[model samples]
Target: MSIFKDFLLKFRESFKGTKPVIHSVLGNVFSMRVIGNKTHGDLAEIALTEYINEFVEDYSAVHTGKEKFRAKKFEEDISVTNKLTGATFPISIKTYGVGPLQLSTNKDGSMFSHLTEIVSKSEITNSQKIKDILKNPCFFNFSKVNVLPLIYDEKNKTFKIILFDLEKAYNSVSKVTYFPPRKYGKDRETFPIYKFFTADEQYIFEVRYGGAGANALQRGMWTHTENASPFFNEILNGTYQINEPLIKLVSKILVSPREKHEKILDLLRQLNGNS
Candidate 1:
């Protein structure tokens, strides 16, 4: 190659090295708390899928969390494809604050019913019950279930991203203890909750049995991000840290008058050869 071509290539490589660690940041500039939980979650699902397509190497993503795809019992929000290997997998995206994170819901209450029977059976010991419960396919319906948690640390005012396999989580538990609703306390466990812990007593996660009726939706496996980060870290290497997203400008633009945005829209159309 020519000396000029070699120098140009080196310059491009050096510039690439200086790129920021976080390619895309997801979160609201204002309080994400102001937005309804479900709305923010849907937005986060789309944002993360786009981020993967744009930034993650050799990967393409498609959003699949719409009502049309509700047939998916696994609750997968997006499907990601490995371009090189031609492998694709579904991921359930969860958006939550730095607190007790709901991992998965008791969809159709099958898991709840199964666990209730297991817990009440007098023939099996508690240890054996837990072992049997974990062995159940209801907890793990598939060979691989991927979960991507986008945690917003309200205290630190930052966001964290982690993609982990749910099967690893099931295997990490060493013990399970049940906590029933308290009779006296103002702030008590409203329902019976089964807490899972690792061998060293690290809180892994919990399964809340929130009644058998309308509250069945609330009955889900929960985990504190800080407590469960270690398990997640081991699964997908680690988490990615991102600062608060620059959403003020985007929000302003969205809420601005149509007349004010007309010029910009025209320019965009012209750039796209639509004008």
Candidate 2:
């Protein structure tokens, strides 16, 4: 098994102490398969708010249900407050497939215009430009933004809830590139996408300029969970794994390639030995 598979398997031992109510909430979440993605996302927000209150220690969660007032005032779906310290955390909840996940939406063209201006005026490196833009208060408020992504991996038929450390990610960024709308595809002439990278040139995320006119509502920042996963190993230890069928064990053994199969066996041995 690759490092990623090993990491996931270790965390897959089933989360303990989960509230029973959460199981029912998750059931409702899965039942929304026929619903639109937007409705699905709304349900995920409610589920996540409840999940945080149940599992996370020292935090009280409040659901900021789709109110236009809160949307304009806050950038997060859930507001978490530390019970002891009274510190507050603004969390954005996203429900997405294993593909690219949007980190934040750019309803207006301000983010795009700001970035373009920086690129034109600043002689700094792409990373510096990103850091600079983030520092601007005119951009997305709250420097310490936290993302709670509920990712559904279609291939594994599993759901994973993990934290995308946007704060740490900002520092890790080493490059940022702009991709204007392609001549082909649905995005053609609709919007532009900005790709972010780490020091090693690993892709971190993208700022998608949602299309023009009615489509403009689609704008947001995005990232692939596969690419963003490694940046947050410590957070991964607390991942909530769900939807895996019992048959996965036998199916994996039968379908995995020989090399990967052997690696899985080796990892199992190591786990057993440690136990």
Candidate whose TM-score is highest: 1
lDDT tens readout by residue for model 2, 95-184: 777767776666665665666777532323565566788777644463444566666654555665666666677777777677765676
Q: What tens-digit string does per-residue lDDT give for candidate 1 at 67-90?
A: 845787676888877777676767
> What's the CA RMSD for each of the models?
8.4, 13.1
**lDDT, each prediction:** 0.61, 0.61
Q: Against the hidden reference, what TM-scores do the models get?
A: 0.70, 0.65
Say which candidate scores most in lDDT. 1
Per-residue lDDT of 28 in model 1 = 42
Model 1 CA lDDT for position 158: 61
